[model samples]
Target chain A: MDQKRKDSASRSRRRFLTDSTAIIGGAVAAAAAPAGALADDKAPSNGNLPPNVPEWMKAPGADVGSQPYGTPSPFEKNVIRNIPKNQPQYTSSASRTPIQDLDGIITPNGLFYERHHGGIPEIDPAQHRLMIHGLVDKPLVLTVEDVRRFPSQSRIHFLECSGNPSYTAMKGKTASDLVGLVSCGEWTGVPLKILLQEAGIKPGAKWVIAEGADAAAMTRSIPIEKCLDDAMIVYSQNGERLRPAQGYPLRVFLPGFEGNMNIKWVRRLHITDEPVYSREETSKYTDLLPSGKARQFTFYMEAKSIITRPSGTQKIEKGFNEITGIAWSGHGKIAKVDVSVDGGKSWKAATLQEPVLTRALTRFRLPWTWDGSPVVIMSRATDETGYVQPSFEELTKPRGLNSFYHNNAIMRWQIAANGEVTNGNA
Target chain B: MATLKVAFAAAMLSLGMSATASAQTHYGIGRPATAAEIAGWNIDINREGTNLPPGSGNVAHGREVFEAQCSSCHGNKGEGGIGDKLVGGQGTLASAKPIKTVGSYWPYATTLFDYIRRAMPLNAPQSLSNDDVYALSAYLLSLNGIVPDTATLDAKSLAAIKMPNRDGFVADPRPDVKDKRCMKDCKP
Candidate 1:
């Protein structure tokens, strides 16, 4: 029965891909062709399945009630965020989707990466209200409905936890095992500037204190200019209301900022003249230098790229393989992604997927023939700002060992002669 | 060449053993943390002394420490330069334009100690001793007029110290009871 289900699922997926591709091709052809060529191209026809089908295929009767809520397909039950146990009460370590195991950038909401400081807060959306107080002209209290009423916009972007690759920084580790705390999805929400405009900011409002409604009451003081710029109060992910783990009903989405700055379960936006000196901003997220002067407010995540397939854990049987992965930058669009198979000795540019927007995940793919020999693979991304992703040595050189956060170094995966994979640096 | 090969083998074997040992050991390597080590590290003191260390200090001694250690960043009178303004500007929260200095905005007294001990001095973080941290906390608190000049601040007295803006903050009551139950029914 499991085999049959698998077969059906594979067939359906193939059909979906083929049909979608054909439809897209036809649309493109029709648009490019002359007016008289319209009838020459016909839309694909749908046919009913044979009557002698499985019981599950039969239409649900009145006894089977309709479901108001939805869940992921049962076939995808195994796909889940793997949370590594540390101390009790502290879920400090977690990993997201094995992106190599999946196709397409839209990670299923259930399988999204999670990194929680305390734990996921069980927040009731109905009871959640966002208060805009402090340096605002009018301290406005907004319900979820009030937010939804505003003109909404949808954007596709990746939210990657900053501590995504701390495990692999040591080297010789598999790619996904090291830095799997990243997931990309289409986020839908209202621009934060619109709401801030509604509230009317005072002249002295330089910093805005964003506080979360959780046991930790996580808070961060974001710059007022950023709030007025591209900040989003997102409510939906991939055409559905956000999952509880992904900040349920409402979350602050600051494009280009590190994931920590994107406050989840948002409760209040206090417009203050100065920073609140929150624990996250001051102590946790701040980068401690060897010189003792810590680098605080390192908000913008620098450009970085990784070759996902033919990476650490996934095996390739010494033949033609497509090296695919994601490249993104908080600064701007990924101008180029260079992949080096022979360590950093030489580099070849990878083909970047289309529509590479600023502060968005740009997918890159490279075709390579793997001989059954030991080889090191790495990818380096250069953003529009002309800042190239540094090597681990280069990143650590100036910062020294005291540095903990914001280590966007080039990752290396070593393919042993025996086909076993290990971290190159280790 | 034979000696080099043997050395390489030994190094590889040691690497393997270390990896195995790392897998077995739960916490990262270091001496088992003593009470002194824990106390030495966990000296974070918030404005209300949420995690103040066990030590006593007075404003006079605090002022001396502040001048020697803190005055480079914060001015002599706690008027901030490169760092932050730590004193004056009280009761400015509700004004059209509020000067939200430490005296005005901070809701807890313990937060001062927490901030100072964790990352302060602008040059060296976690460098101050417990007594130094307490003195700095007292100095900052007295400068802000939260505590008297002669008042001693320690773990015991720090939590008891009331902040001016302590009552300013309120628990969020949004997504109210009405909102929670209003899914099916409307107002009569």
Candidate 2:
């Protein structure tokens, strides 16, 4: 879809949802059903139960091409992104993907959380170009077509904002509001090494400053080691040309780096000996510590996970419950995910849903019996590298709460006797 | 899954043992960039003043530009409004509410110029002349008391004006916090 249409659709979806209560009812209904609610002693039949065939089964469903590009069910209209509230401006704002409402790994392109500095730009592929210069034998300026001409590879990776969990107004917030600045998807593009090798890297080039074409002309200095390692000049997200907001024609995808340095709408790659301390690298994105020294080039996103179902806002009825969440590590694949009930007092290993791709979100689920008592529940993910996801206290001790970015702390949700789930995390 | 990952790791390790990577085969696509083309898109300015463009600006000119172009979002004195606060907040990094403005926290002066040149005025970024950006940088730096009010900045002057917090940055010392695998009766 074009930028204009995509934007309108997004706005309309948000508008319709905000004005309707059916969406809220649907969400509560969604949580109540899907396995756990099967044993509920309430009246089973409400006209659509097993005895009576649902209205949909009695009639022919919509034929193919009804929605040529395809859209989610109308009932799922409220499963849209949470636009950043009270942002300074819409152009330089970020959005939260409704992660709580999603399952599996691949984030739909339209639903991918957006973090644009200068908003989305509609770039014509024919006119767009990517330049690679500085300390290279061949300083190449390739068109989008030329970029596609090179050999390409696809990888499933999780793109997370360093400032994920930027949500501050935690009261009554859903999991989406808590840790929504992250999404996992398949990125298809030419490995940057191939392009850089074609350009022939001259010695002494230690850093590459990737520049974006948005109004901000956003730029970030990336270590040349990362650029040549697993960096990619991605054109396709999931299986399609990237949604305009997700950096249309092209963008840089550093496999495990923090999202800011990924440089969406990437236009230029300038190899240099020293890091370019851009506004982003210095004035922003850096982590301030209690020692008064800010940590620079803090690229890797550490391991993090959150219990999506029964997390915040969502309610659960007594009886058998299925606890599910997502876990990921920038270093590599997740080694294990342990879910804890009774507020971290005891833990049980959750079954990790398979094809747990590296640097991508891994789905994990565990069966539980609620017993109708109040309890605090949470999940902890240990990465393959032996780095366990830290608690808020542990996380804040070293980095401090003001560090703001890279909040990979474990989240807790309190399940009351009445089935209301609330934020147990401070 | 753990076994699968281990097998995958072993295979990667073995592959690493015999890898002689890179350009045995080039698709021969993407022609070399022209000098003019390189100059057009090459807008990044490094901390060491590598890509600083020509032209100069002063605090006086920067003040005018700030009032005209920048102050709308950054506030009258860059104390911040819709945009971020760019001045003051000096020596508050270790404090509870560290206001991390450009003067107080930014390690290099060049970052200010680069940011203003590329993304200032919010509405019309990259429209600022290099001189205007330099002037704005000088003015903001002066407001933060890092530079003299009369100081003019070109590539050299801007690079030479060592920011107060230049040494305030350290390499990322991460994996700093470790979560022990505490299953039951954990420390609360």
Candidate 3:
């Protein structure tokens, strides 16, 4: 099976190269073609190569409902989320999406990154209920049906784990290993504000503690302002029911917040005047500074970007290679991404893909000509708040390497004369 | 007819009182959670001592509970096995190897009780009684030298016991690094 997958991957890679050339050449030719010449030209192939119809053209295709639920093409099996080799335990670990292998903005439900605390719990939707109490005029229990029946809205946003970046243990790992802990999808759900208003929040309520039904009962205390701002109780992903790994029944979706705080398998929310300071916020996700003081409740994931193509482990031929990747910020939409082929010494603004939404991943691409010489390529993102992605040295100087969460430092990829790519900062 | 008019006036006055008291918005969705239902799931503890159950367990009894329920995964002394090491890592947050254990890093003692109660004993979560969770928390705290073997931990004492690193945290002040949108000549 491994060999078969490798063979298919290589075939796709070859086809991609051919298609790129065809596209570039076709663009140039079409621009120069006369308006009448374009419509009258006969296509190269007429159904078949020679005297015989193509097999697909001659045969009857499978009928409808051939696959009740659709799946990605068998040829695209290589595009998947992978659990890193250094994972401490399978029960509580993260599986990263292969960012370099994907395109555009939306992450497929099957390939979205997965972070499990005590493994995925098989929740029965019929029995699932979200209880809201404490500091509320009326304590209420909302079933899955009731939660869904509330007016719903769909918004595209990115979810990134607080521990998205590699730890000090990460020295020579690929860019995918470093920054693959994020995924984007269009989430369909009711705004948390509407729900809170329904519960009639009391005057002194300041924080709302969201708890999951997983074995860990993962909990995080979100400020009332944030909860009422853009938080959602998401039930669907990418136009379909959420995949089990992405929280099948119901989950809290906080736009522009760290992934962990967007609790999955959410079951309970208790409003209070003080932060719960759960184990996650107190012991785990809190950021430690060089002064021996840790920063608590640091929820926002800063602006960051990476060169996914021509990144670590992906080799590119010299000349005419397009450097493309994703940039995002929890604060707002990515304002711009600057690509640097010669490290930070020189940079050029890359083209931002259209329809960039707030708190969502934006794809950036830059066409470059490699000169068969060693060079360092990197991309820096700036969000609407005017926050630029910082270098590793700059980030470590303040917080130090001991800080495990929220490493949005700029990533640099080294390209060798032999067309090989490696991970590094300098 | 006079009694009927008085009754209608009383009803109107009560309705007006209720409207003024609540002054709340209602979307009219979901059922009102019964007290029993709220008690079953409302398991969170804050720094100011809210929602902690009434239970006391000493370090000695906590060791027993830890051995029986937690030892398999967290090691005999909370040193860690498949689970995270609960003791040691004190004063390591600023060092090269920051060991974030229950004793060294956790800011509040209530967090330990809340965590153990909500999710601990890896294989079977929420299986331990509130007393058992308090006991395990006490044992773990004793191992870290924060509590004495004879000391008993109840909701009041637990909330009162200060963590060593309690002062080691500050509110988030972000956008820490500054870099203008310089399109060229960025690197020094």
Candidate 4:
């Protein structure tokens, strides 16, 4: 009886494979093809040829449990995160993501951009405790286990630093340093409103001050409107427990808010009537303008886009290729993105990839046939609220050169006749 | 199978509807926090002068604390070295290369007291006594010419002193710049 069932299953499997061979034959033949191919349809120029039978394939590789945790290949070692240029101290510095080397929307947890105020503190989850007090009717302290026991949701959202391209600071910076301050991840957590309601948010509560347990004791005042809307008490990122560099045990995750406001190693949430103008909010994150006034509490990262492929310091040949990159917004979903091959003179509609979630990175692509002529390439994104991303000149009009944070201006890259691309925004 | 799917979805829909009502459907997960626990972590300072500890320090003691604790990173005169510049930069917000120092652009004086008490001296955060934080705030205020050398800061006095750029901050005026969905013949 078992043999007959197994035989029927084998016949169905053979039939399914045979029927699909005609359509995706080459993909099915991937077993005979090289394991990986370079993006530009070229093999490794270092003579790692197919007929040569590379050394690794000639012998048995390392045993199964050799390295329990997975890692990037040694050849991909250079694809790691890097410290920003001119960062003075390692303790309070940033490790930016290499955007150009990555594809798709999700950034690997290991390669996600990290900006630490007091270096990574080795936090034991058992010792971690989150307190909710201030204007609440009943203040409550919750352990990590108690926090996890609440109804949780997984949301994919992008976390961006308010410090921005400010593009002045990133003048000569290339791909890794270009947009390294932003990354997207699926955060699993309980909504902050649930916790707030549990504490019986008092009538006077309008702003909640989130405080971290780091050496800097980083703190920021979040408006209650945002807290009830999409703020989360995240304990997990990209499926696994939060990485140590990314707040580990717990952190406050406010979708569409600035990175610094998503207080890491979060310990306390004090609901109050007024915004606590902490150093991170008032003095540092404030946006200074030309009229001697600065924009305070600028929480949302506006609509922005960048062409990662053929970006700064890249070489591409003249041929048919797809121009691809990522576009995102904090106000909501990316309603549309346009790609301009001849600078701002003209633009063509880009195809937004499927599953364009709100407050998440949306990959966009446009087909192009390059005739090897010198031209400017860039992208412009418009959010669901119809806020079109402005050019550098347009952005500089209202916000003077003094405004360093919240710069979401359109980025441009110049492709020379030699097929080399470099920074064209400046 | 189809009936089971419909039943499951109906249950989920009812569950979601109850979540919106919110008040009656408490999970009752976390326990009530103790006064001692709240006091230990309730360190944030609001601009309304509330929550400041009951201690005072004058500019004289402030200088000693500044020189010993802060001046290593922030310069002796608060001009900034390894840390951010805490003094000077007055009237520079509109100029090119605007040096936004505490005297020039910080909107509230209470933030200084709050930041120092919660996180300061880089190496030792929350290590400063409430009185020492008040002293450091007074010293910086005097150095920035915002207060007299004899000025002392208690919880009341520190929150009372208004920063020079008190009215210098504006709410987010975004959609501040605009452009259209021009596909071709766009202006350069």
Q: Point out the worst 10-residue segment of candidate 3 chain A by lDDT.
A: A34-43
The C-alpha lDDT values of all candidates are: 0.68, 0.84, 0.83, 0.84
Alpha carbon deviation, residue A198, candidate 1 (Å): 0.5
Chain B TM-scores per candidate, in order, are: 0.66, 0.86, 0.81, 0.85
Against the native complex, each candidate's DockQ, computed on alpha carbons, is 0.02, 0.47, 0.43, 0.42
How many angstroms is the interface RMSD of candidate 2?
2.6
- Model 4 lDDT tens row, A1-426: 699999987886676555445424533453344333442325565333655554344334444786899877544656778676676677887878888888888999998899888888889989989999988777888999999998899999999998767647656446556777899999999999888878876666788999888998899999887887789999999999999999989999998988999999999999888898888888998888888898999998999999988788788889987899999999989999999998889998899998899999999999999999998999999999999998888888888788999888888889999998888876
Off by over 4 Å in 4: A1-48, B1-22
| Model 4 interface CAPRI class | acceptable
Q: Specify the CAPRI tier of model 2.
A: acceptable
- TM-score of candidate 3's A chain against the true A chain: 0.86
Tell me the deviation in Å of residue A259 in model 4: 1.1
Per-residue lDDT value at B117 in model 1:
63
Candidate 3, A1-426: lDDT as tens digits? 699999987886776666656554655665565422323325555434445554444433444686898867444545667767865568788888888888999988888988988799898899999998988888889999999988899999999988877546355456668888899999999998778777877767788999998999999999987876789999999998777777779999999889999999889988888889899998888888777789999989999898898888777787899999999999999999999888778889999998788999999999999999999999999999889898888777777887888888888888999998988564
Model 1 agreement with the true structure over B1-188: per-residue lDDT tens digits: 66675566457436642111111111121122234433433332333444455678888889999999988868997998756677877755444334556676566666677666655664565577878878888888888878888978888887787777555443222111111111122121
Show where candidate 1 strays beyond 4 Å: A1-77, A91-93, A167-172, B1-188
Report the lDDT tens digits of candidate 2 across residue range A1-426: 999999988886666555445544655676555433443335664555666675455434454585788877655667789886776679888888899989898898888998988879999988898999997877888999999989899999999998887424344378888888899999999999888878877767788889998999999998877876789999999899988888879999997789999888889998888888888988788888888888888999999999999788788888889999999999999999999988998888999999988999999999998999899999999999999998888888888767878888888999989999988975
- Tell me which of candidates 1 and 4 scores higher on lDDT: 4
- Flag the better candidate by TM-score, 1 or 3: 3
Evaluate residue B16 in candidate 2 and report its C-alpha lDDT on the 0 to 100 scale: 52
